[model samples]
Target chain A: DQQVKQNSPSLSVQEGRISILNCDYTNSMFDYFLWYKKYPAEGPTFLISISSIKDKNEDGRFTVFLNKSAKHLSLHIVPSQPGDSAVYFCAARAGNNDMRFGAGTRLTVKP
Target chain B: DTAVSQTPKYLVTQMGNDKSIKCEQNLGHDTMYWYKQDSKKFLKIMFSYNNKELIINETVPNRFSPKSPDKAHLNLHINSLELGDSAVYFCASSQGFGEVNYGYTFGSGTRLTVV
Candidate 1:
């Protein structure tokens, strides 16, 4: 069974616009959530993370919001640039070091 | 310099052969892990080691073994490789053996193809 899921397989947004990616998880025990951006032929690089204690976390142009009751999270990027185009993965970790990752959403920032 | 590095970016071999994938982390972390991404792009943990001791061992085949020569290195060796084993293997590291704090750093991944 998939613990984490990204319903959208792909998304497209115009440059300078806002891009939103959504993810959901079935495991309520997950207390830590992370978002990673990956380019082709490269490993995923950490973008931002949110602790279950807080509802939202923002860094620069990126913001991550978590809704524990809904078991959902979203990543928002304002003024999306072409450089932001890549595959984004949502991951959740429980008490132990065990982590589960989503299938990933491919983002296309058109210039 | 790369914090996490894996050798043999691509591996191609016939079925029933044996091969090894080497991983190294220079971040001075005490924990290392191995994850596999299959054709469907699903990433799953295979094994993890802390201070050269096995901490987490997922339900993997017996043919697969993870060896940690030291805290900084974790290598995966596959015996009698099967076609189902074809996937992208990534090596990662973290400071502690818990889910909170000390985020994981992943390597570029080694793509293994079994023909």
Candidate 2:
């Protein structure tokens, strides 16, 4: 059983547009959510995160929104650049340190 | 300098062979974890250690053993490797045990192929 899931496998957006990626989770214990961006051969780097307490968190051009009631979350990147194209993963953390990661979504930003 | 480093970026070995992948973290963290990403790109946790003590051990096979010689190093040893063992393994570290406040930092990853 997958605790976290990314329904969309891929997404494409033009330059200077907004790129949105969605994720869902089945576990109610998850209180912390994080988004990580990964390049082809490199490890995943943290992008943004949101706690269950807040509905949204933004950093620079990246924003993460969480809907605890719906058990869903989304990541939005405004003015998407070519460098923003990569695999994005959504991870959820419960009380324990163990984190559950979604399958990942490949985002393509056209120049 | 890399905060988390895992040796043997790529390993290709025959079935039934024994292999080991070493991981080291210099982030002065108290917890370390090992995660495996299969062909489908599904990442799952295999094990987690805090202060050289085993904290979480997923339902991984007995052939896969994780050893933590110290708090900063966690190594994975696989015995009687099978063809299905081909995947990418990642090592990560965090500041504290069971703390969601501090996010994890992952290594580049070691790709293991069992032929």
Candidate 3:
């Protein structure tokens, strides 16, 4: 069974707009969450992460919001650019480094 | 230079054949893992090794085996390959188990096709 889930398979937005990706988890044991960006035929690159202790974390134009009670998290990119188009994956880590990944969402930014 | 690398980017083999995918990391990470992405596009963890010791083994079949000669290397050997074995396998590494300060890094991936 998948502990982490990315319900939306794909999303599209115009450049200079906001792009938001949502993720949910069934397991409450997950304490660390991260987001990665992947290109075709390339490995997923680390984008940002948030610990369970915090509710929000921001880096540059990328921000991650976490809700422990809801078991949900979101990644937001402001003024999305065409170069930001890619497959974004949300991953979670449990106490022992047991990391689980979501199915991933394909984001397309139209310029 | 690549931090994590996997050999044989693509492989096509017949049924019942055996193949191996090799992975190496120059990042000096102590924990390494193997993840598979199937047709459903879900990234599933198969196995994890820390300091050459197997730490996690998921619901993967016995036909798939992971061998770690050293901390920097983790290899996957699949025997009696079936059509359902076709998927993209990724190798990843982190500093160590339970360390979340740095995100795990992954290799490009190896696409295995079974005929």
Model 1 chain B lDDT-worst window of ten: B95-104
lDDT of 2 by residue, B1-115 (tens): 9999999999999999999999999989989999999998988999999999999999999999999999999999999999999999999999885456557899999999999
Candidate topping DockQ: 3
Worst 10 residues of 2 chain B by lDDT: B95-104
Candidate 3, superposed: residue stretches over 4 Å from native? none
* DockQ-based CAPRI category assigned to the predicted complex of candidate 3: medium
Q: How many clashes (backbone atoms < 3 Å, residues ≥3 apart in a chain or on different chains) does model 3 have?
A: 0
> Model 3 fnat?
0.68
- Model 1 is docked with a DockQ of 0.69
State in Å the error of residue B112, model 2. 0.5
Q: Rank order by lDDT, top first?
A: 3, 1, 2
lDDT of 3 by residue, A1-111 (tens): 889999999999999999999999999888899999999998888899999999999999999999999999999999899999999999999767788999999999999
- Tell me the DockQ of each model, to 2 decimals: 0.69, 0.70, 0.77
Displacement of residue B2 (Cα, Å) in model 1 is 1.4
On DockQ, the stronger of 1 and 3 is 3
Candidate that beats the other on DockQ, 2 or 3, i.e. the better one: 3
The fnat score for candidate 2 comes to 0.62
As a whole number from 0 to 100, the lDDT of residue A21 in candidate 3 is 100
